[model samples]
Target: MNLLWLAVMILALSIGIFLFSLRWIRRWIREDIQRRQAASGKLNAIFEWAERGRQDSLRGLVLPGADLRGADLGPGQEGEPGADLSYSNLRGANLRSVNLRNTNLEGTNLEKANLRGANLKGANLRNANLKRADLTSANLRDADLRGADLKGADLWLTSYNSGTRWPDGFKPPMEAIRMEEE
Candidate 1:
């Protein structure tokens, strides 16, 4: 009789542990799914905003901390490809830690914009007005800056790899060069 009682208690404990573990696993899975869904929703919103900005020239548009990785912002012209963000005004906008890899920003007016810690790898900034913009610690690796005016822009600790393209006769700050060395 005592043996039978001991076996029942052991079985109950095992079942209880199994149930607890199952609940915990399910909860973790649900949370992961929720997080992915939220990320997707945020990405969709950013895409919509970019599209709207393209149509309206992004005048006075503000999209701080947007994750636009692999997004196309070139012109939608017939037979021409790329996400078009040309002729847009983004003055004083906060874009801290945002990802704008491979984005097209030709002729965009970004005067006084705050792009601190942003990733602009491989972006095209030909003729873009970036006067007084804050690019502290931003990554501009392989970015094309032909004709882009960056006068008075804060490039402290900014990263620029060897593949980075600059305007004619343009010189990068010492701090940016140091970051590349590190």
Candidate 2:
């Protein structure tokens, strides 16, 4: 009887240890997966927040080297304000062909960013730093660029309508194209 009881006790201890080890392994795997997904630049969480119109949640967001091509973070339905990404630092970000129409980018730092084919129509870019950024083929129609730093920025083939505002005494680059208001 004593031997049988000892065996039962050992078996229970083993089962408990096994269950604890399994739980720990599962938790570790789940956390590792989350870290890998985020590190891979899959900004699904950011996209979900943007889709939900969580502007406050996106404040001062940092997404350097992120692939945000054709993202529509623009104004919502009529009368709803657009996303406000003021003062965010997105240096070296890949914003190629993104739809940022009617968005607010005031005081944002976009140095060395690749903004080729981006649509900034009606976007407010006041006091933004865009040094050495590529704006090739970007739409600046009706966009407000007052006080923006466009030094070394590539404006080749960039189109701007009459409503687009530039810094005082600033002239558009020769490669900039003028477009008719829509």
Candidate 3:
């Protein structure tokens, strides 16, 4: 009778431990799934119009702190294939390593956007509002910034060349470094 009692107690403890571990594992798995789903939803929303070759206007759009690395908004203009994101609101968005090459962003509101390490080569940003935007280490070679409102923008260690056109009479910030190669 004593031996049987000891065996039952040990089995109960083992079962309890197993059950606790299973619950912990399930909780973590659920959290991970939720995170992935949210990220996927944001990515899909940004790329849906671009992939479908739709030239829809993304004006006044709001998407802050979103991970938009290597994304292409579209090639600007009606004749070409791509979406027009003029006057869109992308404050505080994470645009690291994004591809805005040749895309038109005229009059777009990009205040406080994190454009670190972004690729904005040849992008048409005429009259765009880039106030206080963090553009550290970004590639701005050949980008057109005529009439762009770049007040208080951070351009430290950015890569730009002679082809990068600035707004009329807008002196570049002293921290903005020019690229050696044209």
True lDDT of residue 175, candidate 3:
81
**Which structure is stronger by TM-score: 1 or 2?**
2
Candidate 3 lDDT, 73-118, residue by residue in tens:
6464534634466777677778877767666677877888888888
Which ten contiguous residues of candidate 1 have the minimum total lDDT? 56-65
Count clashing residue pairs in model 1: 7
List the global CA lDDT of all models. 0.72, 0.85, 0.78
Q: Write the per-residue lDDT of candidate 1 for residues 1-182, one digit (tens) a residue.
A: 99999999999999999999999999999998886676568557557866665453333233323344345444444333344455655566566776666667777777888788777777788888889999898888888998999999999988898888889999998878433544
Rank by TM-score, highest first.
2, 3, 1
Residue 20 lDDT (model 1): 100
Provide the lowest-lDDT 10-residue window in model 2. Answer: 54-63
| Per-residue C-alpha lDDT of model 2 across residues 1-182, encoded as one tens digit per residue | 99999999999999999999999999999998876677455467657767676454456766666777778777666545566777888789889998788878999899999999998888889999999999999999989999999999999999998899998888998899999955
Going through the candidates in order, what is the number of backbone clashes in each?
A: 7, 0, 0
Clashing pairs in 1: 72-83, 73-83, 73-84, 74-82, 74-83, 74-84, 75-84
Worst 10 residues of 3 by lDDT: 74-83
Q: After superposition, how far is residue 6 of candidate 2 from its true place, in Å?
A: 60
TM-score of model 1 vs. true structure: 0.57
